[model samples]
Each structure stands twice: as C-alpha cells, then as structure tokens.
Target: MGQSAIGTKMITQIGILVHDIEAVSEAYANFFGVDKPAWNWTDTPDKAQTEFLGEPSQARAKLAFIDMDSLQLELIEPDFHPSTWRNYLEEHGEGPHHIAFVIEGMKEKIAIMESKGMKLQQKGEYTGGRYAYFDSIPQLKVLVELLENDK
Candidate 1:
C-alpha cells in the first residue's frame, strides 16, 4: 500500500501525560465543553510483568479515554511515583505527551524507523496491543509512538 494509504488507515490517538489528573482532565473537558470520560485502568499483573515495565514500579497513573468522531483522546495522569509522563513533565511541564499512529505492519514500520536512527525508548504489549516508544524527538520536543492493535 502507499504511504498515504497506510497512514490514512492508521488509528490516530492523541495522548496527554500530566501530573494532575483532575486538573488536566477538567481542562480538557471544559475546553471541549464535554464531561471528562471515565478512567480505564488495566490491571493485568501477569501481563504487565511479562509485557510492561515490570512490577508497576510505584508509578500509578489514571487514563481517561475520550472518543471523538474520528480520533480518541487519551489523558494520562501520573500519580504516586515517577513515570514517563512525570519525566516529561519534569523536563517540559504540561503539554502533548505522544501522538500515536496505529498501523497493521508495526514491526516493519518500527524496523524502518529504527534504521533511520530513531532509537527505541520502550516496547511492550498492553490490552492486546503492541506499543513502542521511540526517542527521536529533538530536545524539548514531544515524543512519538507506534501502536499496533493486535486485537
């Protein structure tokens, strides 16, 4: 398929990682004049241990998923410990966390991006989907992600 076609078919989700769950959630809700969506916390200890960063590491986070007509907005609030979000916040404060593009050929796309010097930051499977973080962002820039919904 053409690159444009591949990109068009991708499920694009915008994620915001912040320190304050209520504040950020409220801001988005009020900004859009919509109620804050409920949080969906995935607690798969076995799955997380096997796929995620292991043992939760005291990094508690709340995720709110908002579904628009075409795209989904995911608001992530980092509680308790420091997470990737917290790290981003420490460096850049509140802003865009990552722009996720879901594609069918995740492995192939990741390989291509890596070959182009995009280093892999993190990789894991969660809720039947394979996700990876790439450290290609220039200083003070937001990170990018590639998500493959295996389900």
Candidate 2:
C-alpha cells in the first residue's frame, strides 16, 4: 500500500456511532468489566467552530470514551443537527463510524488526503485541539479522522 497521507500508521481511536449513548455505554462497561464513563455533550458550534460540507453547522453529540489497552474507543450519539456523525447514523444505522489518528500539520495532512480523493466531511475544534474527518470509505472501507492535539 502507498504511504499514509497523514504521515503515521498508528491508530489512536475507533469511533462508533450509536442511537442511545447511555444504554450502549452501560452495555460496553458490563462486557468490558470497566466503569461506565460519563457521556458529555460536545462543544457548541460557537465554541467548536464546526463546519460540515464546507458550511457552518450546529452539530453536536453525546460522547463517551473507553480506554482500551491500545486505542481509545469512542461512542458518539449525534444530535439532529447536520454533521458527519449524524449523516452516517441516519443513513447506515449504528456501527463503526471512523478510525482516527493523532497527527501534526493538520492543513498539510488534509491536503494530501484530498489529493488522494478523500474529501473532507467535517471539521471542528475541541478543548485543546482540532479534528477533521475525511470521506475515505472508498479506499479504507471507513472514514478517517485526523486529530491534532496541542503539544
């Protein structure tokens, strides 16, 4: 396979979209024998500066994280507002959403992916970093997310 456009092969996360975060989280906790993590709402559009399909969006989601041995498992329950998460859940139903990588040089990484035919689906800011999701299903069978956290 060609070199990774994002410049690293390590997967930091596996995001899953679900209809009911609370129930799913509980189930996962029981199965994994781990405490159920609390779910929280993602930042508002004003704080996240979210954009979907190049347009500003008011998208948000309830998110929970479960730390695994190697990578983080993310459970997302997106609100009605338009976003990659919402769209995927609406069209495909609940399941794997995207695989994520921690990257530097966000702009350059996005350019490379776009050049390789992976169009960006959504982007937004979080507490101490930013993230962008690309439509890479055609090649990888799932979406790819680039997370650039502050050093």
Candidate 3:
C-alpha cells in the first residue's frame, strides 16, 4: 500500500449522531460503566467560521465526549441548521457519522483528500483548533474528519 493521503493511522475520535444527546450519552455511559459526560454546544458561526459545502453555515450541535484509553467516543445531536451532522441524521437516521484523526497542515491535508476524490463537506474552527470533514463515504464507508490543534 502507498503512504496514506492523510498521513496518519491513529483515529482519535468516532462521532455518532443521535436524536437526543442526553439520553444516548447516558445509555453509553451506563453500558460502558462510566459516568455520563456533560454535553456542550459547538461554537457559534461567528467564532467557528463554519462552512458547509463551500458556503458559510450557521450549524451547531450538542456534543458529549466519552474518553476511552486511546480514543474518544463522541455523541452529537444536531440542531435544525444545515450541516453534515444534521443532513446525515435526517437522511440515514441516528448512527455513526465520522471517524476523526488528529493532524497538522489542515489546508494541505484537505487538498490531498480532495485529490483522492473525497470532496470537502464541512469545516469550522473551535477554541483551540479547527476541523474539516470530507465526504469519504464512497471510499471509506464513513465520513473522515481531520482535527488540527494549535500548538
């Protein structure tokens, strides 16, 4: 096999979309014998600078993170806004949304994925980092998210 286009094999997070974040997060915590985590909303569009399908979007979602040994399991409940999360939930119902990897060079990595025919879907900034999602379902059976944290 050739070098990975994203240049990383470590999947840092698995994002799952649900209709109710609190209910689902509690269920997961109980199932895993861990404490239910507090859920928070993604930053607003003004702070996140969110874009969906190359256009500015005001999408947001409730997010909860459950920490495991090597990766975190994320539960997402999207708002009515137009975003990858909302679209996936409406079209496919609740289920796994994307697998994320920690990375550097956000722009270059995005370009690499695009070269491989994976169209960029959504991107946004967070408090200490930024994220980009690629439409990788046709190739990987799931969306791919790249997280680049500031040093």
| Top model number, lDDT | 2
Query: Per-residue alpha-carbon lDDT of model 3 for 8-119, expressed as tens digits?
Result: 9999999999999989998999999999999999998899999999999999999999999999999999999899999999999998999999999999999999999999
Full-model lDDT for every candidate: 0.67, 0.96, 0.95
Model 1 pairs whose backbones collide? none
Q: With candidate 1 superimposed using the best TM-score fit, by how many Å does residue 49's alpha carbon deviate from the native?
A: 4.5
Work out the TM-score per prediction. 0.76, 0.97, 0.98
Tell me the alpha-carbon RMSD of every candidate.
Answer: 3.7, 1.0, 0.7
How should the candidates be ordered by TM-score, best one leading?
A: 3, 2, 1
Q: In model 1, how large is the Cα lDDT of residue 89?
A: 66
lDDT of 2 by residue, 22-86 (tens): 99999999999999999999998899999999999999999999999999999999999999999
Model 1 agreement with the true structure over 65-104: per-residue lDDT tens digits: 8778788888887564545666676778777888777777
What is residue 88's positional error in candidate 1, in angstroms?
A: 1.3
